[model samples]
Target: MLASASASKAACNQETLNTTSFNYVNDIENQTVHDIAVKFNRGVCDIGRANLMVDVSVVPNVGQTIIIPGQVCHPDWTTCVIDGPGTNDCLIGGPRLYYTLNGDTMWKIAGRLNMTLDAVTCGGDSCNTNITCIDGICPGGGGSQYTANETIPAGQFIKIPITCDIEPYTFSAGVYKDLAEKYGSTVGQIQMLSPTYNYSYIANEGGTFPPIALAKNCRLLSSNYTILS
Candidate 1:
């Protein structure tokens, strides 16, 4: 179906970061998934998979939010939310590199990536002790070290701890139980992976979550070992 409004007016004009695979766009007017996909220069299936939308052929409700994949920021921007080697290639978890965006804080970064503040601050189980910040403000700097809540400037790359590689998921109208079933993960593990949301609250559905980190079937190899021993 065609969009009721002009495609140019309904275009996905949101800000994006480098390597940031998923982006959120609000539907100001009536449009089908195909219409939105065409505006974004992507396939309907790709958008559906990224957003976990059930129907790709139907027209979306007005003011509905949609997720677009493979959209990127300008080439000059160094900021990004690195999602690892994706789900296809098996790899080990370690410090994932994330370049800071303007007005970005450790907590915001963790929430944006579906990670815990501890993981972003290098104090959690996912952090590799051997790998520390080489360019940005790190955990320890005698007196200049910034806390997770402090704002970090753009273009500074930071190392984030990870237990396993991850794949992104957008939450629909579902609880943790539904999310766990969909991803073949336990509710507790999912909660840990996404600590930004309080488990007791059920109204927070239809939001984006940190990419689900892989625990099983990880293909370990010498090349995945990017950390220096």
Candidate 2:
């Protein structure tokens, strides 16, 4: 009787260990699906029936599709279809839309959105403030306007005004120094206004320096800066 009890206890421990390992594996697989969705710029549901399989592992490549068999949940395991890919009718969530001004400091975008730059970028290394034009176009009617401090909704297309000139010459560092020397403004203050250049090669070529507009309220000390074409 003592040997039998010990054998039963060992079996129970093994079962528990197996259960824990299965749960861990399932969690890891779920996370892998989520990460792949984000990386591919596709929706999670797009994985379709292939994502619903149980006791099965799948490795998908870019542009490849797979099918999964549906498994039973806790309440109904018998009725589940385990033979084939379940369904392709998964619905996609809407695209997340946000806005940024070219060459504006990250702090300014965060302040405008009433969110930290870290929050906006999902804590990524890329700077939120230095976003380029191709990120998205200014929405119709000048995009969604917000007060200097407003919390923007996720997936809402924000339209920030392209107030700064795409001056041929001004880069962020140059603008910072120029504003400091001429207007007695600090680099932080100058960066609040978004300054950008229209031509990419000009900025790369180190040609003529252009003056970008200060924010709407900034007073120009000289008439040299032209409105970007």
Candidate 3:
């Protein structure tokens, strides 16, 4: 119901990259379909609302394989564990640009949007400030991370991240308020997206994931032409 979160978050999706294989082993001797189904239920939350491709029936044995999810995996992230709060699912979405007005501070802009410094910065430690570049919206030389004191000139477009949460369940490691705050949303909104622990007496059921949980879908178009020899 928070429409101000914008359509820009919905503008991009990532191409499935080839993964370096990783999986957890169910070393028990007689693992059944039920066992794997329990594991399958723990699959990645597809960020762009895509259907996951599963192939467990073909190899229902002691050495079950599960591909680690996402466009890329970090060095520390290796195996899919039981009830893990581990997957860092960020969509490959294009930033929505914001223009700097006269006397605009990076802090002010970030604060207004509830965006983290990590979201808007150009990335890397230092940005190009030469050629008369002012503020942290340093265009060129690989944009630097946002700094608190950057004095942006008027008419400069700042890149704002289209942040999204793609993990299937609420990962336990993060501060709940930060996530809600970062997206300019509420903790209830986050709770609404993730599966929650339920009480035994309540007859509650989970609805489909909130559409806002994902980044806007992105696609790539490629073309090929054959020239007459």
TM-score top scorer: 1
- Error in Å for residue 140 of model 2: 21
Clashes of each: 1, 3, 5
- What RMSD, rounded to one decimal, does every model reach? 17.0, 22.0, 20.7
lDDT per residue, candidate 1, 195-229, as tens digits? Answer: 33321112223444434432322223433333321
- Residues 112-219, candidate 2, lDDT per residue (tens digit)? 333333433323322223332233321111222443234333223332222222122244332233333454332222333332222121322344444443422223
lDDT by residue (1-229, candidate 3, tens digit) is: 1121232234433353443333445466555333443343322222101212111111233554333333332211111111211111111222334555434455544433333343334343222121122343322212144465566655565543222333444222222333444544433223223322211111111224222242222321223211110
lDDT comparing candidate 2 with the true structure: 0.28
lDDT of candidates 1 onward, in order = 0.41, 0.28, 0.31
- Which portions of model 1 miss their true places by more than 4 Å? 1-95, 124-144, 161-229
TM-score to native of every candidate shown: 0.27, 0.20, 0.23
- Comparing 1 with 3 on lDDT, the higher-scoring candidate is 1
lDDT of 3: 0.31
> What value does the lDDT take at residue 141 in candidate 3?
19
Q: Which residue pairs collide, candidate 1?
A: 114-210
